[model samples]
Target: MAPVAGRPRPGDPLDPDAAISVRGLVKRYGDFVAVDGLDLDIRRGEIFALLGPNGAGKTTTVEICEGYRSRDAGEVRVLGEDPADGARAWKARLGIVLQSGSGDSQLTVRELVTAQASYYADPRDVDEVLALVGLTEKAGLRGRTLSGGQRRRLDVALGIVGRPTLLFLDEPTTGFDPEARRQFWSLIRSLRDLGTTMLLTTHYLDEAEALADRVGVIARGKLVEVAVPSALGGRETAPATVTWTEDGARRTEATATPTAFVADLATRFDGEIPDLAVARPTLEDVYLQMIGDDR
Candidate 1:
C-alpha cells in the first residue's frame, strides 16, 4: 500500500531501525476529524509524552498507534512494524497500561502478573516484576482489593512482566496523591534505566515534565508543537516574570535577564528586593497559553 502524503511509508526508512514512527495519520468520526496528518518518531528507550486538551485528539491518536483502531489514512509503525497489520509477535513486544487496567479485580495481583508473563516467550521474573513496581507486599491482594495507587502499580507490573521493549502508559497517575505520584515517577525512571521505551499520555503537565524526555502538544486535532518539556514554546527563552514589593506596594515586570533586573532593583531599594520572586513561565503556563490561542 502507498504511504499517506507527508508521512513515512512502511518500506521507507525501515523502523525495526526505529522504535516507533507514524506518518500522515488520519482518523475521523463521521463529520468530525479526530486526527489530521499526524507524524511522529519515537526512538528506543525514550519516554515520549503526548499532551493535549480533552478533545485535542491525543487518545484517538494513541488508539490508532496501539492498533485498537485503524487510521482512516496513514502508515504507522510500532516496534518497527506496521501497527495496523501487527501480529501476535509484535503485540507481545509491547506493553500497554490503560487508565483502566485489566483488573481481574477478583484475581490477586500475583495471579494477574503471572498470567500476563505466561503470554510472552521470555518474560521477566514474577518476583522481580513485583519488586520493580514496588508491589511485593501487596502481591497476594486481589487487584480489586488494592487501593487506587496500588492498583495502578499492579497495572504497571502486568505491563512489564512480559518484558516488553516498548510500553504505553495512559494517564497512569490520574487518581494518585502526591507521594504516590512521586513513587510512580521513580518506577518509570527505573524502567527507562532498564532500556524500556515509553509512550505516555497525561492530563497533568507536571507529570509530563517530570517523566517525559520530550513532549508533543496537540491542538484542534493536530500536533501543534513538540519539544523538550523544559523548552516547550520557547519557555526557556520567554522572559521571567519578576515580582517584588517596594514601599508596601507590589510590582512586577517580564525580563529577559532576571538576575540583572533583580540586582538593579536591589540597588534602587538599597536593600533586598522585598518579597521578590523571579518566576519563569512553566510548562503548564506555556501549554495553557498555546491551547487557549488555538481555540
Candidate 2:
C-alpha cells in the first residue's frame, strides 16, 4: 500500500461562503495519517488549483472531497452539504473527470454521455455537451475507437453532461500533447464562463497558470503556500535569472530587476546586449524548486 501523506498544515482562519471547506481534516490508515489537519477554502465560480509532488496527498485529498473516501476527522462541506453524507441529488450538482474508467468503450460517444445524463434530474443536451467538448464530429464513434486525446475529451464531456455547478478536474491534460492540451484549455475556459466552480489538480504548472485563479502548493503532504501563480512560492520576488553572451561566452546573473541590469550592460557593451534575454521563473521552474526537485 502507498504510505499515507502525514503533513497537512494547519493554516489561518478561512472565510465563510467557501464552496469547499476543509477544517482540521484528518485521514488515517491504521497507524499512519494520510492527511493531517488540513484546511482549505475553495471559492464559488473560481478555478482553484491543488498541487503537490507525487505521493504528497493530492489524490487522497481530492478523493475525500469527491466522497469516494471518508476522512477519519475534519469538517468538510462541499456545496453546502457534507460530501460524506450527500445524497444522489446533491452529487448530481458535481462533475468529476477521472483519468480512467469510462469504458463503456463499445458505446458511441453520444450513447455514453446520454447514459450518464439519466442519473441527473436535468442534464444538458448530449449534442451540446459534445459540442462543448469539441467532440461533436466524433459523437457517433465508439469510445474505444477515439484517439487518446479525443477519449480524454469524452471523459470530460461525460463529466459535464449534467451541467454540474462544481467540477473537479483531476489531471485532465496528463496525456495530452501540447496542441491537444491547448484545445482542452479552451474547453475548460468555456465551462468557467458558465460560472462553474472548478477544483483543478494538475501536474502541469502551465495548465494551472492558464486556468486557476489561485493555486495551492503542497510539499511532503503539507500545504506550504497558497497564492496566485505570479506570486506562488515567492516567484515574483525571487531574483530574475538574466542570460547573455559576451565574447561568445554565455554568462548569467540572478538579480532583483533584470531590466535595470540589462540597461547597464547595454551601455557597457556600447550597443545591444548580445543574445540578451531576461528570464523570470516559469510556473514550472518555481514549482520544481518548491518541491525540492531543482537541478
Candidate 3:
C-alpha cells in the first residue's frame, strides 16, 4: 500500500537510526505506577503519535523521554544521548512545544523569537522561522495582543528557531478551532517534510490519523500496541459494516467479506446499490477498545 500522506513508513527506533528510544521504562508515584515496563522507538524522520486517556501514563512517559522527569527504571535515548545527562549542545539538537507557554507580554513576536535564537549556537533565521510557523505577518505584534491561535504559532516558532532534529509536541492544538487546527497541521506536515522527527501527544484521533506514520497506544503505564494508523489494533482486518438503503429504510450487516456482500447486494438490486457504504473500524475505535480493556 502507498504510504500515508505526509508520513513515511515506520522503522525500528533502536536500530541506530532512531531519534528516540525507550526500553523497559518504568515510573512510579509512590504507591501508584504512572509508567510500567514500556518500550517505544521513534524513527529518525517520522511523526509518531502517543495516545491514551487521563492517568494513563502518557504525559509521564513523554516527560521521561524529554528528560524533564526521571525514570525509575529502563533506558531512554533521545538523539543518541540520555536526556538526563544532555548538555547545552545536546539540548540545542531538540525542540519542544509544550501545551502551554510563558512569555513576556510586551515582547513582539520577532523580539521573542530572536531572544530564543540567541540560546543556540546555530539557529534558523528569525524571520524564516516566523514565516515557517505562519507568524511573519504578526512579527511586530506583542505577545499579549495576539489571539490564541497566533500565540500558539509563536510558540511553535520559538520551538523551531534552533533547528532541532527532533520535536516534542504536547497537545499542540488544544484550543484551536477547526480551521486553525487544520492550518497547524499543515505547518507540522511542512516540518516533517524537512525531516524533523516528532513525538506527538494528543487526544484528537483525526489529528493522529492525519499526521502520524505510526501510533502507540499507552494505558496504565504500559504500551498496549504500536502500529501504523490504518492497521492499528488490527483495524485493517477487522469486520466491516456493509450498509445500503432498501425500501425507504436502511439495512446493515457486519461481515468479514464486504466485497462479496456488496456483489450479492448488486445482484439483488440488479443495478447500483443505493446508499451503499462499507465501513471498517476507525483508529479511534481501536484506541478506545485498547484503553478500555486495560482499565
Candidate 4:
C-alpha cells in the first residue's frame, strides 16, 4: 500500500524538495473559520489534486498558496519561497489558470499566445504551445469565435506559454465534453512527464482519479486525508460486494476474499453463475463519505 500523508507537526521542518508545503495553515472570515490548522506537502513534478465541496475552504487555501490572498496565520512555501514575499523571479516560475477565463478577447489564438509568451524570461515557442494544446487549427480564429471546449484549450495554451515550473489549474474541464476532457487529460499527463509540477482543484472525482498522483480531501476547513485515489479511505482493503441471481431472486454478499468466494459459488452451481457482478466503493463514494455528505 502507498504511504498515506497526514498533517505535519507544527515544528516539523519544511520539506526541501517539496514544490509546495504548508504547516498550521489557518484562515478566517469574521466569525467563521474557513481553514484550520491544515498541513500538506506536494512533491515536485507530481500532479496534486485538492478536492472539497463548495464552501469547504479549498479555494481559500489555494488562493493563499498562489499569493493572491493573505493568510491570518500559518506558513506556506511555494517553490521554496514564501508566497507573501515572492518576487518577480519567483512569480515567473508559476502559472495560474482560473476557473473562468478571458477567452472572449478579440485577438486571434496565435496573437494572444504570442503576447503571453513575451511575459516570461524563457517562454515556449508560440506555435508549439498552441499545438501542444491542440489549438493550432484555431490559430487564426478570434477567441470569441471559438467553441467552449476550444476556448478552454486556448486558456491552457496561454497558461503554458510561459513554461512555468509550477502551474495551478482551477476547474480546468468545466465546459468540456467527455472526449474533450479526455484529450485535455492527455495534455496534462504530457506536462507531468516533462517535469512540470501541478496543483489542481476540481469537482470531478473521475478527473482526479485519472490524472492526480496524490489527492487531498478538505472538509469543513481541515484536510481529512491524503492518499492515492485507489487507496483513499482504505478503499483498497474494503470488502467487495458480490451479487448474483439465485432462487429466482437477486442476492448479495460482501467478502474480503472475493476470488475464493466466487470460486466456491461456481462449484455450488456447477456452472457459470447467473448475473454475477463484483463491485467496490468508487472514488466518488469515498469522497462523499469523507466530507460527511449525508445527501
Candidate 5:
C-alpha cells in the first residue's frame, strides 16, 4: 500500500520536527512477521493516535519505539536518536503510561510522584504535577485507597512529573467510565496545549477523534492509512445517510449532497421534515472499513 499522503516516503530525509520516525520497520517472531516494513512519522507537539485491533502488531511496534523490544530491520528514531541506543538523558525525555496502572502502592500520591520526579534532571514541580492530574486532593491518600479513575490520574501524574517532551499513552482511558473518560480527554488536551508531543494507542475510535491531531491505522503489520480523524479514508467525501419519517414509516436515503436533499425534503413537507437526521460516515465507520478483512 502507498504511504499516506503528506507522510515521509521511505529514504526521505528525517524530519527534524518529528518526535518519532520509522522507515521500513520490521519485526519477526520465529517465521511469523509481526511488523512488516511499517513507516510512520509523528510530528513534534502533536497527539498522534495509533489504532489497530488485537494481534495487529501495534503493540510490538510501540515496544520497538519505546526501546523495550528489538527490530529485525528498519530505522526507528525517537527524539532524533535511535531508541535501541537511547541513553539516560534520551530516556529521561520520555514518559510512558501503560494500559494498566502500576499495582497499588504503599506510597501516597505525593510521595509516588516525588520519587518519580527525582529521576529527571529537571522535573515538573511535584505539587504541580498532582494538580495537573487532578489528584491534589488525593495526594495524602495512599495509592491502594484511590478509586479507579483516581489511580489512572495518578498514573498520568507520574508520567508527566518528569517533564517529558514526548509521552506514550497505551489505552490511557481503558476501563474508565463515561464521565471519567471525558475528564481524561480534557487532561490530554491540556498536555497538548503545553506543547507535549504524544503517541497514543487506543481502541477507542471516538477518543482518537476527540484527542488526536492525526490517527494511523495498522493492520497485518502495515500502516494502512494516516490522516486527521475527519479526513481518514476520505470520510469527508463519503456519502451521507439521511433518515426521516415519511408516510408514517421511516425512510432512509443515501446522498452525496445532504444539504440539497434536505432542502428539497423541507419543500416537500412544505416547511419542516419529520424526524430528520442526516449523518455522514463517522470516524468509526471509516476506521472499520479501512481495517476490514484484516481484522
Candidate 6:
C-alpha cells in the first residue's frame, strides 16, 4: 500500500510560471490504482478541461491538486505551492466550485457571499460578486429557495468572492437548461478574460469545447491525449464527410479535400448540389475515438 503523503521527489521543483503542475503522479486505494504515473501542466490564465469517463482518475487527480486528498507519490503544485503543504495564504489564492451546490439552507445569498468574503485578505465586494454571478436580484433569498440554475450561479459567486487567481470548477453547468448553460459559458469566459486560470472537469463535451483553451482526456488511470478543442486527437485535420441528395437518394463520401469534392459535385450536377453538407470530425468524435482506442 502506498503512503498517503510523501515528500516531493528530488529534481521535481515547483514551477512558478505554471498554475498547476504534476510529475509522475501516483495514487492508490487499497490494492487498486486510481492514478498511475500521470503528468500534467496547466499554464497561467487559461481554462483547461480534464475530461474522462466515470471511474477514471479525473476526480482523484483534481482532489490531489486541491489539497483535499493526499497523493501516494508525486510532485504536485498549485499556485507555486505544494498542495499537501499549502498554508492558509496559499489556499486563499485558489477557489473550488464543486459539482453540488452548498447545503446551507438557512443563509441568504447575500449573507453567504458576505460570510465567504470575510475569509480572504482582499476579497471582492459582496454586491459586485453577486452581480457578477447574476444573483443580485436574489440576494435576500434563502439558499434552498433558488432554482437549480440559480443555485449553481450562487456556487460560482461563492467561489469567485475571494478573487482567487486559480479556480477549479467541477461540472459547473451540469443541471442548467440550454439557455442557462450558455449564460454560464459567458460568465466563465468573462472570468478567463480577467486572467483567472481555471481547471474544469465536466462530462459534457460541448461544455468543454466551449470553455477550454485546451482539453486533456484521461482513461484507465492515464492521460490519453491533450490538445486544443479544435485539434484534440487530430480533429481539425480529420477526413471530411461530403453528402448530397442524388436521384432522390442520399449519397455520401469521405475525402481529404472537401472543397475539391464539392466543386466536382457542382460540375457533375451542372449547377447546384442538392441538400449538400460537408462535415469533419467534431471534438466529440475525436474524444470518443481516443477513449475507444484506450480500451
Number of the top-ranking candidate, with TM-score as the measure? 4
Task: Summarize candidate 3's per-residue lDDT along 213-232 as a digit string, tens digits.
Answer: 88888899888887889988
Better of 3 and 6 by lDDT: 6
lDDT values, one for every candidate: 0.85, 0.83, 0.86, 0.89, 0.89, 0.87
Residues 1-295 of candidate 5: C-alpha lDDT, one tens digit per residue: 2233466667776555589999999999998999999889998888999999988898899889988899999998899999999799999999988776777899999999999998999999998888888898999999999988898889898889898999999888888899999989999999999999999999999999999989999999999888988999998998999999989999999999999999988888966788999998998898888889985
lDDT of 2 by residue, 64-145 (tens): 8889999998778898888899799889999998756467579999999999999998899988998888998998999999
lDDT of 5: 0.89
Q: After superposition, how far is residue 58 of candidate 3 from its true place, in Å?
A: 1.4
Error of 5 at 88 (Å): 0.2
How many pairs of residues in model 6 come into backbone collision? 0
RMSD of each: 3.9, 5.0, 3.8, 1.9, 2.3, 5.2
lDDT of 1 at 8: 42
Better of 2 and 5 by lDDT: 5
Over 1-295, each residue of candidate 1 has an lDDT whose tens digit, in order, gives 2221122433354344557787777888998898987777777778989999988888888878788888898778888778889799999999999866775578898889998898998999999999989999988988878988888888899888988899999888989999989989999999999999999999999999999988989888877777888889899889999998877889989999999988888888765667989998999899999899666
lDDT of candidate model 6 versus the reference: 0.87
lDDT of 3 at 154: 87
Backbone atom clashes (below 3 Å) for every candidate: 1, 0, 0, 0, 0, 0
Q: What ranges in model 5 sit over 4 Å off?
A: 1-5
Per-candidate TM-scores read 0.93, 0.91, 0.92, 0.95, 0.94, 0.93
Model 6: per-residue Cα lDDT over 88-167, one tens digit each: 99989999898766676889999999999999999999998888889989999999889999999999999999999999
Q: Write the per-residue lDDT of candidate 4 for residues 32-144, one digit (tens) a residue.
A: 99998888898888899999998889888988998888999989999999999978899889988877775478999999999988889999999899889999889999989
| Candidate 4 residue pairs in backbone clash | none
**TM-score: which is higher, 1 or 4?**
4
Question: How many clashing residue pairs are found in candidate 5?
Answer: 0
Cα-based lDDT at residue 71, candidate 2: 90
